[model samples]
Target: MDTRHFTFALRHHMVADTLLLEFHGELDAWADLELAPRVAALLRRRRRAVLVDLRSVTFLDAGGLRLLLRISERSPRRKGRVRLVLDSPQILRVLRITGVDGVFTVLGELPVPFAADDTPDDTDVPA
Candidate 1:
C-alpha cells in the first residue's frame, strides 16, 4: 500500500449550527483511528449538521470506507444530519463500485451554515 500520503488531517469548523470536518490525505483503515473516534464522539455530543469534507483526500481504503459507513449509518439517528463533500474521481469511483455512495448525501461543495434538523443551544463542541 502506498504510504506516501498516508497521513490525514481532520479539521473542525463551526459555522452557525453546522460543524464541518474537513479531511486531507489518505483515508484508509488507519485513518479510522484519527477520524472515526472523533466523529463518533461528535455524534454523541453535538446535535447539529455535519459536513465531512473529503475533497482533499488523496487515497482511501476499506478502513477509511468503514468510518464513512459508520457515520452514514449512525449519525442520522444520533445527530442532526450528515453530508459528505467529495471531489476525487478515484475515491468517488471506489465508493460507487462498492455501493457505499448510495448511503450518503454526497455533495461537490459544502453549503455554508448547514441547517440543522432541530435547533439546540449553541455550544462549542470539538471534533
Candidate 2:
C-alpha cells in the first residue's frame, strides 16, 4: 500500500463578515481523505457565508467536488453558506459539467466584505 499525504495551507479573507477560505494545495483524493474534514472544521466558525478559493489548487477530482458539495449543503443548516472562488477554466468546467455549478455561488474572485448592497437572502442563512 502506498501512503500519500497532502500538505495544505489555509488562509481566510473576511468579506462583509463572511469568511473566504483560500486553499493552497492539490484538492485531490489525498486531500478529500485527509484535509476535507479539517477544512470543514476550520470553516465552522460564526459567520453566515464562506467561500473556498480553489484558484491556487493544482489538481481537483471527483472527491474534491464532492467535498465542496457537502460543505455547501451543510453550511445552510448552520445559518451559513459556502461559495467557490475558482478562476481556472478547467475547474469551472468541472463544476458546471457536474451540474453543481448552481449548488454553490461562485464569484469573479474572492469578494471581500460582501458588498454593501450585496446582501444574501435569509433562506437558511442568518442575517
Candidate 3:
C-alpha cells in the first residue's frame, strides 16, 4: 500500500484589528496539526477579529471543518470574532452537507484593505 501525506500553506495578514489567514492546498489531519499552534498563538492575542480565507483551498475534510469550528469557539472567549471566506462550490457543498454553513460567518472575497495588494501573485506567507 502507498501512503500519501498532504500539506497546506497558510498566509497570515493583519488588517487593522483583524487577523486574516489565507489557506491554500489541502487542509487535512497534517494541516490541522501544523496549524493548531500558530492559530492558538494568534487567538491568545485577542485580536478584534479573525478571517480565514478558504478561497484557494483545494480540499477540506472533517478535520479541517472541525478546526474552523474550534477556532470560532476559541475566538469568542478571547473577545474576538471568526469568519470564513469560501469561493469554491465544491467546498461550499462540504460545509452545507456538514450543516456548518449557517454556523459560521461566510464571505465570498477578502474584505477591503486586506484586498489591496501591490502584487497580485505575491503571497505573504510565513516560514
Q: What TM-scores do the predictions have?
A: 0.75, 0.71, 0.82
Winner on TM-score between 1 and 3 is 3
Q: Candidate 2 vs candidate 3: which has greater lDDT?
A: 3
lDDT of 2 by residue, 4-66 (tens): 333544555566656656666666666666666665665566567667778877777897777
Over the stretch 8-75, how does candidate 3's per-residue lDDT look in tens digits? Answer: 77777677777777888887777777777777777788777888889989999987887788778767
For candidate 1, lDDT tens digit of each residue in 1-127?
5545448766665666566667777887777875677777776655456777788789988988998888766564444347789888999999899998887778986564543322333322223
Shift of residue 6 alpha carbon in model 2, Å = 3.2
Candidate 3 wrong stretches, greater than 4 Å? 1-6, 77-81, 117-127
Best by TM-score: 3
Query: Relative to the unseen true structure, what is the C-alpha lDDT of residue 29 in candidate 2, on a scale of 0 to 100?
Result: 64
lDDT of 1: 0.71
Angstrom error at residue 111, model 1: 1.7
Candidate 2: regions farther than 4 A off:
1-8, 13-16, 77-81, 112-127
Q: What is the lDDT of residue 105 in candidate 1?
A: 78
Model 3 Cα shift for residue 1 (angstroms): 21
Residue 41 local lDDT, model 2: 65
